[model samples]
Target chain A: NAGVTQTPKFRILKIGQSMTLQCAQDMNHNYMYWYRQDPGMGLKLIYYSVGAGITDKGEVPNGYNVSRSTTEDFPLRLELAAPSQTSVYFCASSLLVLPDSTEQFFGPGTRLTVL
Target chain B: TQLLEQSPQFLSIQEGENLTVYCNSSSVFSSLQWYRQEPGEGPVLLVTVVTGGEVKKLKRLTFQFGDARKDSSLHITAAQPGDTGLYLCAGKDTNAGKSTFGDGTTLTVKP
Candidate 1:
């Protein structure tokens, strides 16, 4: 099913630059999430969507925005990049929020570095 | 936000030894998941324990959820080089639609 896929495996951005990280899932999951992993730290959620038109902020949503216009695509936007925004980003999808449905499939990851 | 803490932040062991990684939290969860991540790669789900005191096995790996659903542990038997990676635990709160993650346990199994 190709599960979940993310674009731009590696990227470097200058301070104040902007870009969008793309994520897609063919699994037709109802839930999609964006998370960032700083070096030597646990992952922190940036944003998430429960459905195609429903989006919400997560643990760490600063410097980031998201849009879920379709069931398969959830994109994260960086308005003005900062060194603090440098981290590995992951996209994941799941069927629902039920305990049995908590198994999330993750994309390879997108590594971003801001200078 | 709920927090999860993992123990033995780093470990280096011989290929044939056994190891256990722990995830603990002060809050209860509906379910807990274990994942393995290799360098430059996102985590892959290894197992998910939903019920309190539930136990599951995969190959040489055994996963156990705490009776109160506030903790979990992953044990690997006769570890191998292929087992070297960062192991992570995530706790899910269905009602909140959010999953909190532990920092992770980095394991190095030398051949």
Candidate 2:
């Protein structure tokens, strides 16, 4: 099913440059998320969507934005990229949280290096 | 926000040895999931425990959920080099699609 797929597996951005990280899932999951992982740190949530028209902020949502135009896609937008934003980003999809889904399917991850 | 903490942040073991990784938290949960990730790749689900005090076995690996659903453990009966990877535990939170993930345990198995 190709599960979840992310675009631009790697990217290098300059100070103040902006870009969008693309994430899509073919499993028709109702929940999708964006997370970032720094060296020696656990993955922190940046943004998430419950459906095509509903979205919410997560633990670390600063310097980033997200849009859920369709149930199959959730893209993260980085505005005025900073060195602090340089980290490995992952996209994940799950059926639903709470009483339904406990397992999450993750994407290949996008490695970003701000120079 | 709820938080999950993992112990033995790093472990190095020889082949055929036994090893255990722990995930703990103070907040009660309905379910817990374990995932393993290799370098340059995303995490893959290993197992999920829903009912409290539930125990599940997969090949040489065993997973247990705490009776209170506040903790979980993964035990490897016979470690192999293929088991070398980062292990993470996550719990479903009340915040809809959000979840709390523990700091992963990185294991290195020497064969």
Candidate 3:
């Protein structure tokens, strides 16, 4: 299983520009999440999906959107990008929620730079 | 909001030395996890502790969850250059239905 994979390993966007970070997992996980990591900062969740057609806002969801149309794909959209959005983005998937299972498989991550 | 704080934000030590990194929070969690990340890469899960006072070991590394379920510790014995990376702790709050992450501890092992 390719586990989780993210597209555009690196990207640079101008202010006000928009882009989509694509993520896919072959593990058939029901839970997928998008997180951004800043230097010295662990990670801040942007959005997550319990399943296809169901999404929720996480800790830091501003300037970002997500869609989980299939169990395999969960994409993050950044609209009107700002310099504050510059960070490394990661995609992760887990079979179940906490108290039962907390093991999350993560993607390599996409490095984004907004100027 | 639940928050996790990691101590010794950065650590540089010689090979063969031992070290411990801590993650503390006032909020209790249903489960806690530890992950290690390398430059330009995403974090990889090291272990998860679900019970209070739980202890898990992975090779030269040991993970312990606080008896109150509010803190954790990661101890590495005889560290090697391969162990150099960023260590992160995440707590899962069942009530909040979300995970809180600590700032992370950066460790460098010199040979």
Q: Among these predicted structures, which one has the highest DockQ?
A: 1
lDDT of 1 by residue, A1-115 (tens): 8989999999999999999999999998999999999987778999999999999999999999999999999999999999999999999999974567778899999999999
lDDT of each: 0.93, 0.91, 0.93
**lDDT (0-100) at residue A43 of candidate 1?**
88
Local lDDT at B64 for model 2:
99
Please give the distance, in angstroms, between residue B34's alpha carbon in candidate 3 and its true position after superposition: 0.4
| Rank list by DockQ | 1, 3, 2
Which has the higher DockQ value, candidate number 1 or candidate number 3?
1
Give lDDT tens digits, candidate 1, residues B27-84: 9998999999998888888998999999999999999999999999999999999999
Q: Which residue runs does candidate 1 get wrong by more than 4 Å?
A: none
Q: For all the predictions, what are the DockQ values?
A: 0.79, 0.70, 0.74
Give the alpha carbon lDDT tens digit for every residue of A1-115 in model 2: 9999998999999999999999999999998999999876678999988899888999999999999989999999999999999999999998874574657899999999998
Task: For model 1, name the residue pairs that clash.
Answer: none
Could you tell me which 10 consecutive residues in candidate 3 chain A have the lowest summed lDDT? A95-104
Quote the lDDT for A64 in model 3: 96
| Stretches of model 3 off by over 4 angstroms after superposition | A97-100
What local lDDT does model 1 show for residue B13? 99
lDDT of 3 by residue, A47-96 (tens): 98888999999999999999988999999999899999999999999888
Classified by CAPRI criteria, candidate 1 counts as medium
Q: Give candidate 2's TM-score.
A: 0.96
lDDT of 2 by residue, B35-104 (tens): 8999999989999888999999999999999999999999998899999999999887744557789989
